[model samples]
Target: MTRLGVTFVATLCFACDARMQLATRTSDLDEQLTIPSDHDLELEIDDALGKKHREDLDRALDAREPGEQLEHAQLSQLALDRQVFTLDDLFRVGDDLFAYQFRPEQGLGNGLAGHVGIEAGPGAAPNLRRVQQNAFGGPDAMSCGDCHAVGGDDGAGTLTQNTYFRGDGDRTLESDVRNAPAVLGLGPIQALATEMSSELASGRAAAIVMATTAGTSVTVPLTAKGLSFGSITALPDGTVDASHVTGVSPDLVVRPFGWKGHQPTLREMIKESFRVHLGIVSLVDQQAVRDGRVSSSLYGDGPWYDVDNDGANIEVEDGMLSTMVAYLSQLEIPIVQPPDDPSLLDRFARGRAVFDQVQCGTCHVRSLTLVDPIVVTHAEQTENTASPTVAIDVARAGMRPKIQAIDLIGSAYGVPLFSDLRRHEMGTELASPVEQIAGGAPIPKTQWLTRPLWGLADTAPYLHDGRAPTISDAVRAHGGEAQASRDAFVALPDDDRSALLVYLLSLARTHKLVAP
Candidate 1:
């Protein structure tokens, strides 16, 4: 039941023209796209040769300047006019982990426009030396791919000017929280997203995000436009979901993993990937740095951002945090489905024993192990050659590689496996006080986190902010702490939940990477 592919109009038209500023067909704002009559999304734009890229989105929204704005020099002139703020070979990585920013035609485009970013408007002021990090412990933060991106092609290469900050308010977030979660196909959805870790109950139950006006401080830029990445709305069954962000508090529901989900593994979410998305700081000794409580009046003054023109004042050192967590823990998860069929591997081993006789294997737990492949080859030789040791010990001693654990034959070969990496409560009839975590609280509109369910039959409008679509309407829209595992998967019998939805549409698959 998973075959929805015209390759989803070229992966949602290259993820909606690289997430936002839509209307593609090589858009230059393609007649400022308005098709939405609830377009529901299929996106096609030709509108008569879309008046040829409207002067390249009006010279990329009138290129600004404040010590060379949106640095990496405007994503290298929008990747020399292939356009849309360039940096898209779908995040490359070839010449042996592209030897730290290689050069030739400079294909990796100076480390992919040094992680793409530059929109100084919306009242734009806060660059206070690129607001380093405060994360948990709070205030001062910046990590939208530290400009726009980092590394891939079998991974390791992020270093967008190492920055840091710790504890002081008015908005700071670099205690390394991290939220990338879009690795394409993550090796058969890392064992069908850890089959919901057998009703977890322990992994330290994290997710905190406090500070609602307590004397009114302010400083929250990670971007999705001013810090509010959760909240969708509209449901009396019209299904929109995600809606709970007012003074938040039920232990902070961040559940995206790390600095809160406290690392249950994506190899500890790729060793807290470059202090969770570019606040830098990663030698991998792990945790310790605290100090907070200011409230207001603290914006400039001290070593922030003129980084070096000898206007003097230095202090930065994330140097691409262990090469962006060794090119994101050796990326290569994209398997989606290739075994091709040996009687569909005996009906995926009889839907892997009816996904462990429902209880969805208690918070989706199955096989485990992956955390030490010599700390993932010394975090990919400390992210490409500052040399932390790389011989690949005879190809990891004849391919011992780990990161696997899937189910439903590894998501029918791709995603919807169901999760358990941690974080769940799922009740306020499926809550959404606008998603958050890390102390400020409010994460239990039935608190959620065990939702990996890889490519759940080709990315849809599902939970964790997508809200449910199918798979029995996301198991009858599961209720609080998954209402006794959705009434034990609705008392199974209908041909064992139709053989567990034919073992979750045989865990569909697609993206590919594998080469070490």
Candidate 2:
């Protein structure tokens, strides 16, 4: 269980005009976001104020065009196809693709806007991008940048950007709501998960062997990366009772993505996202269709090239997914930013102490070490197809603002993501309306992975459903396993409570100038 990400976004709100445009409160450099050429786009960024800063963001997205219309994104796709990494080239291509807007002509939806041939209006083309909620998916966004543009190009989203997943495909009530999460330092996150999974597997295997040899039941503590996920009971009968297992799923694999800890690999997350979030199907989708896991082609059962019913074929290329993975995996990690004022700084320090005092650090582990910094990614491949592999040392290939340490608590490097990478029963107060389908474990509606609090302040409107508007509100909403910490927080003095809030606000993304 892990969700590690950050970006250059601050939650402080400033005054804006009556139009309700988004104000770039990050920095002066954020005012002029540089949209890379070659991957130019022409968009109709909306002016309607869906949430806090969306109007201005939509306007900004619309301004990202380079005059010429690159129909069907052919030029950008060509550019991505040629970028086979040298790490440098992957970053260059990924940087552009992360913010590239998609139009319906490029197959951006299955049915969010409507069926494949339905008209939005008098002359509007079919499958016009809409933010409507549904069971199958919202396909509610035009680009990754649309929802992720809270504080940066790769930041978390506002409540307006929340989407309902795993639903009835028609009604919004039957779906699971999810907030758009920030994406940062994903390469190393996968690396850490892989290492931890191996360690847990070895421990479980040892427990099984011991149980068989001794002809008695044995319980093994599934510990990994210094975090404890309780113990699993194994019997000589070859049955494993995971009744006491905490955090991780039944199999002891540490999936590091999704609020529910669903995805095991970053590439798989990207591949699913392309099809579910955006209508652009990947090679994985094609394989899923062949295996009868999902239906492709909205109309005539699309050929292998086009999975979505949209006219475009091979909308998202395999190489494009690979480059995007490289780009997202290398995004900047979050940093602690204390206030400059003496009083506030004192409050922040005290709040930091209070954070530990209230046992918030138990689940939100202050530091977790990444023993192996090298991350391997595989291109889209089926059981029969060959997938190219790209191995990158995130410590070297990652963007700036790396979380550095000397001894690193007896590991290769420190990743201060402030999470134990385990799931907890969040209780009925925060339970999803739907049980939902996820990979690995049978996650109940009341369970959720401990979201990494590295960029807590930047990603406002907290919680899986984006129900909490502030950090304090988010803390108050905690139930189940976190109830003790929440009770401790409630018992604090008024000033200490304020101090605690101040300290949590310091968990923000550091200042950096980035072009998309």
Candidate 3:
């Protein structure tokens, strides 16, 4: 068990008519967070919060009227004014309210939102039989943090927690299992993806214009952060041909969020995850269902406002969604921990050289420097969606140093996130039976975005399916474009192989302090 000392600062807000001051209190407790432990650390931490605070939270939750929206800003002000809350109270209240275990009396109704036969609305069917079949059905887990709690608090999931999709409720042979990836360093990844997408789109657009004006076909090379996504051929007819496009979407947008790189932004990913994994439909999806843009069958019944018919709307209102995204957007990047022993340091250095010599660095490009770190706030349009925004204090959100390291070669904000963020052919062995359509085109199951290795040391049971028990197993499992690299790794001398593994293990990330 890990013991953490956390302090909370109470601020008095007088700007608004409501005079509130967050009450100040201190408590020393053992915080069970991160790594594999013998005990149920999460439950222990929750129990450690004491009965009084838990009751207060329960009362506050019960006080909310059904269908009423919880104003994040207002609640935050109240929390600060009340000062008797824990540090978790400040961040988890608005974003993780529904994440807590709920009882029937609390309006959650048996606390199993995804159980089949639960009436959604008037004459509506029970929650759909299949998890991930569509939004508002099957409920894989109770909360987002539940699946992502393998290595640590908010870490990746284990093989047991792997989500099975495209099948009946039972784990049938037809189901496809997807290993949950860690959510760390996603803020920088989103920023890098946004930049790469803009660059690709701009380059392709220019090529099209030039080709049309010249009355000749022009090939535009779509390259960003040292990764090439083949090229786009612009014909003289003012139309673009994407037959040569290898990696990204035809629109040249780089979506680096999902396993297939389908989700474009963190906010979008959060909303979709809420709907698909937890059956917490967002207001946007609800409206889409109401407008017939989405099938009403996807969600159960008639009362569109309360699709799940769980008494409260509890549909992950826009404010709650934005707050969750903000929390995710400010997560710390994986830090590379150097070995304390000199001999171990020497071995790690040798392994890093061996890694580069074996050509594994080709797809796993070490770092991509950002000209300017993209700061996504609630007030700005970060993605293509029209979702409502909320202003989040980045400093207060608990983030490590924005710039992980400096890339002199790239001369930008160095992000040592060991990935090119481009899709690659992963060969038949890793390919799925079904195809995933993205940006109006069918994506081959074998093609996937290169998995970033920044937090590789902590997140184990590697690969998209958590099939590999060790790092070496994951390397050996690599095929297609990485076949040559895998072969080289296999052929390396024993000492070199050990060095390489040591080097990889150095890439670790620690949990961030919710409060100082």
Candidate 4:
């Protein structure tokens, strides 16, 4: 209701590349800005939220003061819709957002422990109430940069930044400890997934039609973008036997984000991250209140929907998600930078050959051909009003050194992503203690998403969690579907193995060198 700053709504993006530099620099407001890692909410409680007309919600707000404020108003989504801001401008704004450190005054947190979003109702992760205050404890991080600062901007998180999700907030062992993944080249990844899902759906539909027409069972190999995803058998009765289908969701959709690959779109993934990591609810979250999905913590007669009763309405505005996606989609792609030295370069080549020799490329495929480069964002009517989309050509229009731009508009090129973006059984060694509950159902404990290894060299402490300190350890820790590759890597000669590591280490992300 009481919107601030920019004309309409847009924010929460374009960092990780610019975040570390900004985050490392001290700010004048640094001393006063902090989320105390303690459940000492005794001082947070406050008075009336203006009226008795909405007595129950207001009383709840008063009791749980929430104590949040907004320092800067968000940018309007109209800026992108009306072409008032260019792609570069959107990226720059998103960068500012990604680096902006939130304080209590700017509506940061309302309990990530003991509850998910400062509440104990249907929204709470029931067992997680008395968890650690912050520091991988709950939604206690002050900013995305706080955790995503280890390797580079939008890089992997270190041990300190690991987060415990969907568990008893009090204890570390009871929760899911996840290492924050690098947030680079997400647009193409999501696009590839979208295309894959469509192809799979079409394949399934064709099988169904054939089966119905022929009045017999029709089995078809599930191929998308030239790779096989096993097969599906369709019977004449319009029933599909998907048990033979491999490596994808029951819906046949590929989720390129998350350790378990549950998220479908950048908008959904980014919004979820803000809520789970920063306690900042977006307009989409407000929609949850209307849908009776997530509880509404409305405070007083404000025009904006207050999700956590933090009094900071529209914390992450409606349009911010779209631009953020645009910014993320355009960030620089990772490069296969081999060492310059002759011996080391030789090792890199050997490792590349060995990578295939040992079959690591079986799942960690060297590259995938993307037929189309256009990644469209914000095409849905999420939080009501202004459902506009910006289509970015992933092969062009990004923060320079666009390494993967060879496949120009409407062309196909190999994306050296080193991932199939499919789920695999990681065995007990790499598996988590508990199954990750996503979209209501529980994902199997051993099934893990194939992490894109484009930025592999920079993202430290590998694996689903940050258990493996080095890449070698991560390789040995592999099991289930990757067990064969892991064993082969282990049995390799010392020199061969070293060469393999060199090849893996070559998978580095590129950053601009700025001379100040």
Choose the strongest candidate by TM-score: 2
Encode model 1's per-residue lDDT on 253-307: one tens digit a residue. 3333421243333444443342223222222221111122322112222122221
Tens digits of lDDT, candidate 3, 1-516: 011211112222334222111111111111111232445455444434643365455557647852222342213322333346433443455334434543322223213344456544322322333335522335556556777877675688888887776555554455666788988877778878888888888878899899999999999887876678888899998898888887887777788987788888877888777666665666666666766777766655546666556554545555455556666766667866555443465576577788899998998888877665654634121221443334333323444534443444534676778889888999999986567667777778899888999888889889988989999999999999999999999999999999999889877876432311
How many clashes in each structure? 95, 6, 9, 23
Cα lDDT tens digits for candidate 4, 399-500: 543535343464575677888888888888777777655545566889988888887888988877798899998888899989888899999999999998
Model 1 TM-score relative to the real fold: 0.29
Global local distance difference test of model 3: 0.64
- Which stretches of model 1 miss by more than 4 angstroms? 1-90, 93-182, 185-278, 281-302, 306-339, 345-441, 444-446, 455-479, 486-505, 508-516
Model 4 has a clash total of 23
Which stretches in model 3 have alpha-carbon errors above 4 Å? Answer: 1-99, 102-131, 134-137, 301-303, 308-314, 377-397, 405-411, 511-516
As a TM-score, model 2 comes out at 0.79
Locate the minimum summed-lDDT window of 10 residues in model 3: 22-31
- Candidate 3 has a TM-score of 0.76
Ten contiguous residues minimizing lDDT sum, candidate 4: 1-10
Mind giving the per-residue lDDT tens digits that candidate 2 earns over 208-278?
89999999999988899778888999899877898888888888888889998888888878866766677
lDDT of 2 at 331: 70
Model 2 segments more than 4 A misplaced: 1-84, 111-135, 169-171, 237-239, 291-304, 382-387, 408-411, 514-516
